[model samples]
Target: MSDYQPKILSGGEHRSDDEIMADYGVSEDSPLVIMELLQRFHVKDIMRSRNIISLTRENTLREAKELMRDNKISGLPILEGKRLFGMVSMNQIIKALEGGWLDDPCQQHMSTSLVVLEEDIPVSIALKYFHNYTFGRFPVLNKEHEFVGILSQRDITSALLKELTSEISKLEGKTEAAVVEQRPVENVKSEWVIPYYSLRQFVIVRNDLANAGKAANEIKRMLKEAGVNSKIVRKVAVAAYELEINVCIHSLGGSLTIVLDTHKVTIIAKDNGPGIKDVDWACQDGTSTANDWIRSMGFGAGMGLSNCKRVADTFNIKSVVPTGTTVICEFNLSA
Candidate 1:
């Protein structure tokens, strides 16, 4: 009567994780046999030989679709001369078919944008890039943006599993590094008023949402070192980032004010861009003017205003079309 259920997941060693299965159950010869099989076989060990199917900007969408069907390919790497430009696939073409009428250049239906990575870059880096864009494949590039080859989801997943197998072997040998114990989040009480020395006009022109988050984290670290606690810092971060993304997605750009005092915290964002035409509609969930690029990054969920409202005690948005928008939020520490 072991207290553990086999299907139940425990943090460390569940009833049957790799370590538990390897150390307690697997035959010594089994691991070696598996390793040999992986080395002798598996796509990860070999240079990928998948034929590179591609399209040009000038090609008609019909031609691209025909190539995909005739060749039994799911994706295509788009190119201009020898330079890797973007990528398109059957999925996007289907989406276009369902969403709108399509009779134009491949560039119109095609995703003429991509975030390429170096050929030698780690698969982990490629995976992160994949998270930001819903593309089936990517053109591998050299330093000069020259098309070297391409990477696919199939290759990336195989590499991940291969690395995983090595780790399983390490755990079998009892040579795994000791992991640091994690403390509970409740163990930490959020602090207020993170004092800062170099706090000035932080004009963060964030093109990427991830960069916006990073800038906020750096500011939090600065404030924490100055004696601010985690709670107040997170409020500032949420308010600051929502406003920042509002600028990145909808506005030109904006500056933030990180003013800290004994009683309150204020964050202000001002940007020049397409001001919200209808505040009531824009504030509704799932309402957004974000393009595919912005939507892919997990923004434009129409949650920005709601998020700000939840975190900031006072939230305000004022805008004029063809002019600019201003979002002001404040948190009261005294409460």
Candidate 2:
């Protein structure tokens, strides 16, 4: 056996909730429509499940380096009979070459402090991880803890960009006059609306992309069922979706509460920790701390907060650094 000590999470830090959220928070640049797309897809939808290049613990570091070079990948997971033991990154290869241990087994120097994504998580949450961490790729696992695939920023970006382009094309196909006519309905308020009431809460899991916009979709569906105006439903749905995504992407974990009364619909998204540093800055459109990878995936555009604010008749946000963030968006039902 090689004498090298395995390094913990050499690819990225095991960050605290506050640290992670503070590094990157809500943004307002990407179209709110893309928010739906982000929620529509999951990691399994875009992850590279086939032809995944991986290695065994007993594989030599020299072989790992050669595979990385040939494949132009920066990292490889070290497996022990389908179990993820650790990862071997390019940094480890350099150190091995320098230390004259290139022939050693991968288990001797692989990074064990790993960051992984669930196969079922929404692509939106995965995009956030790519923004927050420096790792070029993350190993994906199923609920059974079985390694299923590999998720790369490039693959996600390519897939989302294609969808975004297609969506944009559809939007552009509509005439300006048609769009202008639709705006009034979105802004309209009616005193003649039927009374509707409900209260519900949804658990928002940290990095749980698999169920990212479920709350919003549920809220939208419920409101429509309750006979709410289409315009009011759209606004409430947009707000709920943005906040829900924020909690999923930024918070350690939290809950989304939706209150529907006769007069208005209120959505409150509150998270546990990893809060924002500057609430004012975070609310600004096109202001985001998301890294290049996230931007490439059409997220971290700094429009999440702004998107919510733009549609809500009442909007309020309160945050404490390293603690958490709470945002409320209310849409008046009565004009």
Candidate 3:
């Protein structure tokens, strides 16, 4: 929260497959392969859809609390015939008890200011939702806007770990027997390095929404032409686009510079004056200082830095009030 000091967050370090599986550590902040998996998997793929514990609006608060206790859950969606009405949390139950309103209908005490997710959303976006919102679980709806399932962090982590273990084992050429035996990843001392070299800088004009993504698109094209792995290219492209748009909207003006080499692709965004006051707060998802005009154009949803950090192998941000800010996103290519 310091205004003068830089805030840095790094993840997606090239960890061995075994370490990832042991901790079920797959996340949006994981490596290129894991990030790709998140993008490929939808919310429905990991959401709890079967035998979901729910209560109807007509149900009393006492019944809601009983269902939560019996199922060992903290929240329950208020639904009637697959149609979601509201949500009741454990806190509401406690309050009802203290107020002697435990026998009241759930609809009278349920929380209506709900944040929900679509069943078709990617796990990557779902992770962003989890980071942005404090809700322990999100109700999922289908194309017809009917309540379908509930998604939790636990569901995503467990599903991603299983997918990661299987994919990594296959990529490492581990035999079926070795994989079944849970072979140590340290035994495989190998790495694949992609040789590449490029450097480019683009001048971004302030409030230039029309041309904001040009630089990032060029970067994506060059990487594809260079034959970089699709997954790796995707991560770099996403980070690049987010950074490019950030520079265009946030600062008076700025420049985006991209460097590609044997080890990784680095995207640096440097802006003019009017630096951020709290770099730490700015990095968090759903934190924004954007004006209404910018938000109306869909330019600042506060996902810029968060998206860059989620996809980049390493992310760094620095700012000095009235001086400007610089953000660097690096995507590792090796291992």
Candidate lDDT (C-alpha), each: 0.59, 0.76, 0.76
TM-score of 2: 0.47
Q: Which ten residues in a row have the lowest lDDT in candidate 2?
A: 2-11
* Candidate 1: segments with Cα more than 4 A from true spot: 1-199, 206-210
Sort all candidates by lDDT, best to worst. 2, 3, 1
Candidate 3 lDDT over 1-335, as tens digits, reads 11111111122325444444434465434454554566568999888855788888889999999988988999998887777888999999999999999999998889876777888877766776666557788888887768888899999989988987776654454234323433213433222223335566677666556568987997888788767788989999998888888877787667777777777888999988699998888989999877554675576789889999989989999998899999998888773
Q: Any idea what lDDT model 1 has?
A: 0.59
Listed in order, each prediction's TM-score against the native is: 0.41, 0.47, 0.45
* Stretches > 4 Å off in candidate 2: 1-30, 176-335
For residues 169-282, write the lDDT of model 1, one tens digit per residue: 644432222121111124232343333312333554434343466546655765676565679778778877777777755765555556565666777777766677898888
After best superposition, candidate 1 residue 21: deviation in angstroms?
A: 41
Error of 1 at 291 (Å): 1.5
What is the alpha-carbon lDDT of model 2 when measured against the actual structure? 0.76
Clash count in backbone of candidate 2: 15
The residue-level lDDT of candidate 2 at 309 comes to 92
Residue 271 miss distance in model 3 (angstroms): 47
